[model samples]
Target: MASVNTLPGMAPTLAGKTAYVAICGLGMAADLADGLEAAGARVAIITDDTSCFASRSGVEAAFAAVAERVGPADLVVHAAASRALCGAQKLTSFGEAGFRCADTALRATLYALQAAHGQMAGRGGAIVVLGPAMSLVGASNLVPLVTATEGQRALVKSGARQWGRCGITVNWLAAVSELFAAELAGMDPGGPELGEACALGRRPQWAMDIAPVLAFLGSDAGRSITGASINMDGGEWMTP
Candidate 1:
C-alpha cells in the first residue's frame, strides 16, 4: 500500500498521498477508495449508515478491506439515515417523521465535514461527499432529501471557503440513475423503479461510473476546485 504501484503506462495521480474521508458507505465510496489507492493515495477513514452496515455488514467490511491495503483513517464517513431525493409535495406532507429523516441527512453530512476538517487542520487533505442530482433539482417527493442535500451543498461551498486556507478541499459529486435502489432515488415513494421513468431510453448510471470524478475531487487534480458540486450524471442535469 505504501509502494507506488503503477501500470506500464498508467500514471499515478494520488501516489504517496495521505488522508481522505468517505461518507455514504455505498458502492461508489468503495470504488472511490480503490481509485484513490491506485493513484497512490491512501484512505484514512469511512463512515456510513449504521443500520445499513448492520443489515448486511458489507459496507463496514469494505472499509476493513481498505484498511488491510492502506493504513487506518482518522475519521469515518457516518451517513445520516435519510433519503436521497425528497419531493416538495413530500415535504409538505412530511410530518415529524419527515423532518427527522431530513435532519439525519443534514446532520450526517455536517458531522462528516466537521470530522474531516478537524483532521485536516494541521496537514490538510480532501473530503468528498456522495450526493445525488435531485438534491440540486428538487422534485415533488424530494422535499426532505432536497432540504438536507441543499444544506450539504452549501456546506461544501462554505467548507471550501473556510478550509482552503488550511489546504483542505471540500467537494461533492452527483450521479443520476433510475436503477439505484437507495431511498434517495426519488423515482418513487413506494418501491424501487429500475427503469420506468427514462424518457431518453438509456440505462441508469452504474455506481462505478461516478467514482472517478469523486477520486479526482479527492486527488491533486481537483486542488483548485473546492466548494463546488461536480456532476457525474451523464447529461442528466447541468445547472451547477
Candidate 2:
C-alpha cells in the first residue's frame, strides 16, 4: 500500500485534479498512484485486464464507463510494459507470441491515448506513457518489445502535434527496461553497465528516480511540455 504523505504546498501539485491511470502491465501502479495522490489528485486505476486493452473499442468502453462511474479525468497515464524479452526472428517463428509482446504494448498505448482524447476533449488534460530506453539503443534479441516502445515514441509526437490544439499535452517518459522487471531487456543488473559506466553510477528508484518527474508532468509546471521524451533512467541511458 502506498502512503498518503502529500506535500502541503508543492509547485507540481495536481490539486483539484483527477488522474486516471489507464494501467496495463506496469505492476499494479500502486506506488505511482500514491505519487499522484501526493500531488493532490484523486487517483483511479483502471483496466489491468488484457481484454480491456486488446482493442480500441475496449479501451474506449472502459474509459466511458469509468467516467460515468466517477467523472472525467484531468490527466491520464499509460505505462504498459512486459518483463519478457525475445529475439526478432525467434518471435516471428513463434507467431502471435512475438507479435503479442510487441503489438500489445503499442496498441494499448494507442487505445489509452485515443480514449483519453475523447475523455478530456474540450476540457483539456495531459497524457503520458512509458517507453523503454531500448527504443534508442536496441537490446540484444529484444526487437519486438523495442519496436513497440519506439513506436510509442513516434505516437507521442503524433498525438502531441494533433492534440496540442485541444490543450492536451502528450509526452513519452523514457525509462530503462529494468524498471519494469525487464532484467534481460535492460542493462545487466549484476554486471558492469552495458555500454558505458552510468553517469549516476546507479539505477533509478521508483520514488526517488521516477515519481517526481511524473508529479511534475501532472502539475501545472509541465503543462507546456509535450511530445518530448524525458529520460529518467538515473543517467544510465542518455540521448541527445
Candidate 3:
C-alpha cells in the first residue's frame, strides 16, 4: 500500500496496521476508513446491514466473523451511534423510539468494546469510540443522543482503567456534526448564528480534521494516552 501522510511528522502512523470500522454507512465512518487506508492500514467495515445490534451475542458473533476474515485488528473504531435528531419532547414523550435509540447507541458501543477487548486480550490494541461533541455542550433537541454519547465517554474512561494491564487503550473522540453546514443552511431566519456560537467562528472540516486524531490514538505514539476525550469540534466547546 502506498503511504500517505495523515499528519505532519507522523509518517503514516498506521502503517501495516489493520483497522475494523463499525457503521460504515455514516459519513464519518467512510472518512475514517479512507483515512486509515491512506495511512497504510488495511480497513474492514462492520455494519448492521449484515449483523444485528439488538443483542450482545449478535454483536459478538458479528465481530467474530469480521476477525475471521481480517485476522486480528490493530484498531477497532466504533462509530455506530444513533444520529437521529429529536427534540426535548422525545425525551419526556411516551414512546419506544427514545428507548430504542439509546439502546442501539449505548449497547452497540459497549458490545463493540467488549468484543474488541476480548480479541486483543493478551496482545494489546486501540479502541476509538466516535461520539458527538453536542453531548458535551448539550443541545435542545438531542437529549437521547447526548445521553448515549456521554455515557459512552464515561465507559471509555472505565474501560481504559480496567484494561490498562492488558495493554488496551480506550479513548473517545467528540466530533461536530457532519451535517453542520447543511443544517445551518436550513436554520430559521430568526435562529442563532452558527459562527457566533463557536469560538473559532467556523465549523470543523468533517473527516480531515478528525482522521489524524484517530491515527494518533491508534498508533504507538498514543499508547501513553488513554482514558481521554479529545474534542475535535474546532472551538465549539472548551474544557480545562
Give the alpha carbon lDDT tens digit for every residue of 137-206 in model 2.
7665566767788888899899999999999999888875556544344335443223345678786655
Work out candidate 1's RMSD over C-alphas: 6.6
Residue pairs clashing in model 2 are none
Residue by residue across 1-54, what tens digits does model 1's lDDT show?
222233322245556665444555334445445545655555554545322332
Backbone steric clashes in candidate 2, count: 0
Better of 1 and 3 by lDDT: 3
RMSD of each candidate relative to the true structure: 6.6, 3.4, 3.6
Q: At residue 192, give the lDDT of candidate 3.
A: 27
Better of 1 and 2 by TM-score: 2
**TM-score, structure 2 vs. true:** 0.84
Off by over 4 Å in 2: 1-12, 82-96, 182-196
Task: Extract clashing residue pairs from model 3.
Answer: none
> Using lDDT as the measure, what is the rank order of every candidate, best first?
2, 3, 1
TM-score of each: 0.69, 0.84, 0.84
Cα deviation in Å at residue 30, candidate 2? Answer: 1.0
